[model samples]
Target chain A: MDRLSVPTSRPLTRLIEALNRMPGIGPKMAQRLAYYLLRASAEEAQTLAEAIVAVKEEAVLCAICQNTADTSPCTLCQDPTRDRSLICVVEEPLDVLALERSGAFKGLYHVLHGCISPIDGVGPEDLKVRELLARIHDGEVQEVIMATNPNLEGEATSMYVQRLLSPLGVKVSRLARGLPFGGDVEYADEVTLSRALQDRHSL
Target chain B: MLGGTRLGEADRLVTLYTQRRGKVRAVVRGALRPRSRLGGHIQPLSHCQLMLTESKGLDVVTGCQIIGPLFPMREDLVHHARGFYLMELIDCFCPEGLENPALFSLLVDTLEHLCLGEGGERVLRRFEVRLLDITGFRPELHCCLGCQQALEPVTNYLSPSAGGLLCRACAPEQSPVHSVSVNTVKVLRLLREADMETVNRLNLAPDLAAELEAALRSYIQYVLERSIKSGVWLERLRREFGPNGALGGPQNGR
Candidate 1:
């Protein structure tokens, strides 16, 4: 606790505590990080600070896909080079990284940011699902890939999205098995994610 | 812990999942009272018919009757650790509001198998494989990730990172690979294809058992995204039993 008791700003203390709670980073690491930031040159520190601030200020939720982006239409949504017909829906921004790392998906993406959980009082309305439907309402998309994490919430979210999208007559596919069991999109290798994307079957 | 909380008493935490609701924590009122029937049924890893009183945010458990208690799970450390592993995985993997009969049945059957004397290892392996399938992380056991051709039973590398077998045709492309045997592939297939009851009946040799353990560990590492405390404890448990690994004496059917 003493190491964590930084005689600095309240915001710094709070960030340290929050970072400490994150998996893999211990209190010491959190404190070191906090102290390093405090000691860092103003211009260098501003780069990190500005990036964090810009995440909220510059990034707007893509009106169509709901992924955070500088533009209302995210790069994925805007990209004409990618498969406009295929939409890979995921739970969070990190999931986008996971898919991208796999070098497999060459399509648009929708970030739900969360899954439905009655226990947690998180309903479909809590997610960016309406925007997803709005995209489908345009009637050009051919396939919807439900790449929510392979966990309960992820499955439930995908199922909900699938049921919603199915009524619209668009093909809804799920990632085929090949990703590690219970593995998240973030950790999956390029090979596995690519294969899973290729083997995706209609739900 | 047995769940119950009222204005007069302290909070009691109980993990719950119902057909109507998914996984959640609720408190019961007066469950600890000596006269309370709720205490009789509300125990860890016990199957029960519970009536939930839907509250404003968190629900309350009004009543419950013991459907079955996984008594054998607690009797031994290996079974206990395994049971905890299943419960934690189910708790973490399953989200709230989703009624997956598949996951529920898998949990119940796997617990039942763990209680039974025969083939605990096989039952657990089968459960892990199926749990992944039901959720969506189905391993590509049939072929290599790159070439798309079928890999011979033992000719592929089991890469957790790559998500499945890396056939020799495509192995050079994938750098990190785990050496996998034909027996391992067959056992994994048996798990994927067989029902829980059939899976519980298979007799596993030491080598097969070790292979299964390795495969499952990596698979879990891939999916769970984080480590479970019980997993670390399980390693210690097996070491305590013997260097050969988690085998109980004749009575527990290690």
Candidate 2:
């Protein structure tokens, strides 16, 4: 049965349809959220709407790293205390946030925004790769750490970048693979376990 | 499976090719988290059996088991690129919900060959020819498309725009045609008709392999009306690593 045909009020139906379009939200969830908003105070609804609008209106892609920021070049790119000699390359702005949350990497970042995925018609030219190369050519960067995801597209993107950086004579490396923190080794997949074993370190 | 992207925090949108359904996109819930059982069975280039539940838009993958992960392809960069290239070919040519068992088997066979350490150039050329055949875009190799005469055991022209080979006498009429050697012609014919087992036994000279690759790539580009992305990456790998660098050394098995 169509959620739109539920005989709801016009404003309520509109809200349900809009919420249904969001990721991971089904018609049932959309309707539930719509009802919650319908009963909430007007100020609560206005604040939510305003936050969405503010994000779109205020967010800009940082010039150097291509991450979303309120200001151009972003705080990470402008920070003089951060190590500029090492650049960690990642696939998205969200990945930068995840890495930052871990607090393990203190180097600067270059967000490619996406990986090379032919299934989606995304290629090297479609990504921010040219900007990355330009940065390397114009800066004093020595090592580039490929921190793309562990998926196939991610691996390919890192390899693609590695090949391009090879000609520039800069040291290029990928993030070490191993068991995640707090994860049991017995439950790990064979591929990940094998990679972790191959990349094991000496105490 | 072709590949997938992380959907939400723990879910994934996976692209799969099946014998019954040509290509499918499904959502696998909790595929990203460490304890998710579905994560190991759906890696890109992996062949798997999936139990899906039909939803409003995309199907949901409820259960999965790995049939073949093609793990070696992932371990090596060149093999990995070639594997992705094969998947991209299917993704580009095959439409969703259309049944194509032959194409599906061809893909599985090619990936299996790659897993066995078969040279990528040979496997890719064979794959291209078979793909064109299954898709009804097989180019005429025995005779000229324009003059309709049997091609001689000499150099000929392959016209991508004309969709087949042209005799030397008729070559000038076509605005653009690639000069193809008789050896390349014979090899293409063999690949189109032979099984993977038979094709695997044959070894192509490097020059012939290069010629065959160029001709088929041009033909495929014309058919799709654009160049394939993986083909561009393969060419880039060739240019950067030399012929043997990324794709591995040429196999000369008789």
Best by DockQ: 2
lDDT of 1 at B152: 72
Candidate 2 lDDT over residue span A2-78, tens digit each: 65857898888888999999987888888899999989999999999999999999999999999999999899999
Q: Candidate 2: deviation at residue B6, Å? A: 4.3
Q: Name the regions of candidate 2 deviating beyond 4 angstroms.
A: A1-38, A78-81, A182-187, B5-9, B19-25, B49-63, B95-102, B135-137, B145-148, B154-164, B168-179, B193-210, B221-227, B239-254
Report the poorest 10 consecutive residues by lDDT, candidate 1 chain B: B1-10
Estimate the TM-score of every prediction. Answer: 0.52, 0.82
- Superposition error at B52 for model 1 (Å): 0.5
For model 1, residues A1-203, the per-residue Cα lDDT tens digits are 54565475787888789778865577778889888888899998889979978887887877777777788777777787898889999889878988999898899888988875433446677888888999899888999999975433455567557757877999998876455455466544333345578677789
Model 1 - which docking category? incorrect
lDDT tens string, model 2, B36-96?
6677667888887889999999999988766776788876667877887888888889888
Q: Write down the C-alpha DockQ for each prediction.
A: 0.01, 0.31
